[model samples]
Target: MKKEWVFGTVIGISLVLGACGAASTSDDYDPNEAGAEDIEPDMAGFVMDQDENRILVVTPMDEETAKEGRAMWVSEAPEGLWIGKQVEVWVDGAIAESFPEQATAERVQELEMSEVEGADLKASEALSTALSEADRENILAVELLAFDQQADQWTVKLKERGDSQGEWKTIVKDEK
Candidate 1:
């Protein structure tokens, strides 16, 4: 009787461990992988602060008592993503567990808007021109180009979205 019980217990333990390994969601993903697949934002929102080679998106909360907004991170800013522009992003992994959670975006898409949606046509045109004129070899992506009301300036920063040296530049509001 003791031998039968002990054997059964060992077999159960082995089966449980084997099942756990087989069911892992991250088997295809390595958190430490240098180049992980880009995420498509499961959460979508307006671009908040584009700082630190990441775009902070402010997503709305469903519960009234919950914080009015949640901030998520996107490693690469899609073409034409600027302050006030809307975007939908999907993450590669879970957001970092911290005071403000953040996740790396696998994919990003600019939300189309009608005129009533507060679309900035003039700014959009100008941005397109700037991007075309920029030195492609050096500037991988333009993370942000927003006017700072307090500073009375237009903040422009650039960085290598993939594999290049990051750069930052400030364009005075009137200088443009």
Candidate 2:
């Protein structure tokens, strides 16, 4: 009886220790690598929104060139995608203002669609009207990294050399 009791006590203690000594969640699992079933059934923004500014195509470079330039950029936030008539950049709302081409949007709609392919029609016209519009201060395709308070404008942080070959980051601190 004494032998049996000692054996059971040892097994119970071992089981408790084993459960207690289990590693923490991160140590035992990868938070970044989770499956659909593991995640909450209704996780908003779980499919993260794509960052449009990640690829800054400075106007004039065009999409093809911008695609090519992504490889050349370092720091990743200071470059621009040069689309034919404009450049695009990532900017916080503070210093940079993005006004939709509401005026020419109708004009773009008026353009004949027969000559344009369905995939390219609307954007092509919108882009064209946006470039030519009277209101177009023509801010496009560049990773604007800073909004300087003193100058009252966004500052471009381009990667001109070595490891710093991309846009570092941008700041638009001026409120509205």
Candidate 3:
């Protein structure tokens, strides 16, 4: 009778431990269901231009060229958006297929600039300088390379139309 009772107690403990282990493993499992936090933006790019109601966004195809990059018009643009600001946009529905495609922005969020601390030159200023240098035509893209706050200079790279190589230009910050 002593032997049977010990064996029965051991079995019960084993069963309890097994059930706990199973429960823990199951609790760690995730179904990966889509939630609000799981939602991703449909498009992300730099703001090329903006109006009261809309903003144009352009994504560069590569580091050197934006000629073939996708362009989209985001309607109902959020306030505080300015030219050359990077943003992520969630579209309300399907995008219209057109040059500078149109879509309604369900949500828009500004992306943090990587290295713009204490910079005097803004992205729009850099773009304007590049455009003027390129004769305001045949300019594929303008990319900000770096900003030197001590020197008050901005290094901007310009990709001209039909050019395989991009040229880097240094722009002194305007005191206006």
Candidate 4:
């Protein structure tokens, strides 16, 4: 009877420890790993709703280039921007590790789709229109990333080289 009681106690303690170890493993999991299910918002799309901070985007394959019908929540809204325009976003990960995943945006960028020979369409004019006065001053260069038709805008990536030298900060801009 003594041996049996000792064995049972050992088993119970081992089970408790094992359960704790399993929980810790999940808590320490990194979302940025290669096999992680985190979505990469490398493709361009449109703003679905500004109030909700959501963007409608598609994950494009190198060849296929169209995943279609996907929307995610943004963490912050880019300034001077509204809904119904083309925008790009950087998502952190799924809101929950479950099926039919929902994404949370880390950054949001507006894009310019239509171009007309006017003050609003010109790069200098468009830049001012796209970004606030503070943002424009920090930007060094702008590069056109891709054209998103659904958003009806041209996706552009901007960079502000920190000191006219090595380090740079990237900013996203859109033309209304």
Candidate 5:
């Protein structure tokens, strides 16, 4: 009986070890690799920030609209109808720097205004305090529709938030 127990333990350990060995492991495996598949913005896109560390996380939503869309940063309470505000957006997870110039806290009081909903809320006012330029630029826009009930989270669309340089660019027109 003791021998059987010992043998069983050995076999179990071997099977576990074999399973682990069979599974592929990359020392360079990146948790952030999935970020690329989530957000599809015209420029650089949004990020979920936690203190000094910010990462591009995917949203759960399938369809996106001009008035309603996803968000990365989660606040305790609804940030309140986000609208026109000058924001410094980025796409591939850029950080603060200088070359052309750092995008300081510029107030985008007026969005060129796309199918993207325009609201009275300022970007600075709607967003959390002290946001990185990457976060601001990454944001597509705030929704004007029924978003009050949505739990704070981001969503990806079958299509990206289409826009035209703050201009009201034409989306899909009904084909007659």
Candidate 6:
């Protein structure tokens, strides 16, 4: 009789412990991978321009030209997004393949900016300085490069009026 009682008690304790462990693990969920229904973003890039209704995002290509890079006009952009800020956008439907492609932003997530090693200049400031230096009619893309002790380097791709191709120009901004 005593043996039976001890065995039952041990089984009950084991079940309780298993239940507690499962609950704890479930509570420690990741926000990025919230559930199986979470969809991946269709595109990711830097916010080059924004207005009340839409935002322009430009992805830089490795060919040293902005012509190959993809640019998208994402509507329904969430608040708190600014120029030079990185973001991931989920497109709701088909993307129109214009110079700056158009798509409705189903969901826009502002990506956390990682700390740039040995950098003193802000991304927005870098972009602004590059734009001023380029002095072109239109901007294709602005990319933050490296930072030396004296200045931060940026590659600005610009297009002049009536030009078919954009030009890539390097601009350096002094550290403040």
| Residue pairs in clash, model 5 | 44-90, 44-91, 45-91, 45-138, 85-108, 86-108, 88-137, 89-137, 112-166, 113-166
- lDDT of candidate 6 over 1-176, digit per residue (tens): 99999999999999999988883446555445746346678888777777776988777555455344678889987776466667788898899988778999888877776665666666555665665456444645544344455445544444332245645666665466
Q: Quantify all predictions' global Cα lDDT against the true fold.
A: 0.56, 0.30, 0.66, 0.46, 0.32, 0.67
C-alpha lDDT (0 to 100) for residue 75 of candidate 1: 72
TM-score of 3: 0.58
Clashes per prediction? 11, 28, 0, 4, 10, 0
- Model 4 residue 114 distance off true place after TM-score fit, in angstroms: 4.5
Q: Which stretches of candidate 3 lie over 4 Å from their true place?
A: 1-35, 64-67, 115-118, 121-140, 148-151, 158-176
Please provide, for model 5 over 49-147, each residue's C-alpha lDDT reduced to its tens digit, 9 standing for 90 to 100. 332222322232333533423343322211333322222233333323322222222111122323323333322233322232223343333222121
C-alpha positional error of residue 108 in candidate 4 after TM-score superposition, expressed in Å: 0.9
lDDT of 4 by residue, 1-176 (tens): 99999999999999999988883447756656777776555435544333444433322222244222333445445555454456667666656433223567666666665654322233434333333322433322333344444454434444333345222222323344
lDDT ranking, high to low: 6, 3, 1, 4, 5, 2
lDDT of 5: 0.32
TM-score per candidate: 0.40, 0.21, 0.58, 0.32, 0.21, 0.61
| lDDT string, candidate 1, 1-176, tens digits | 99999999999999999988884466577544787655444777656455656876655333355334455667756555465556787777677865345788777777774432222343434344444445544323445555555555455554433345455454534233
Report the C-alpha lDDT of model 2 over 56-148, residue by residue, as the tens digit. Answer: 222222335443122111113332332222222322222222321111100000112232222222332333332333221222333323334
- Per-residue error (Å), model 5, residue 115: 13
Off-target runs (Cα >4 Å) in candidate 6 are 1-33, 64-67, 132-136, 150-163, 168-176
* lDDT tens per residue, model 3, 1-176: 99999999999999999988883335444334454234577888766666787977777447554345667889987777456667888888889998668999988878776546776556555554544455433324455456767877776664433445455455656343
Q: TM-score ranking from best to worst?
A: 6, 3, 1, 4, 2, 5
Following a full C-alpha superposition, what root-mean-square deviation does model 5 have from the true structure? 16.3
Q: Superposing all C-alpha atoms, what RMSD in Å does each candidate have to the true structure?
A: 13.0, 18.3, 8.1, 15.7, 16.3, 8.1
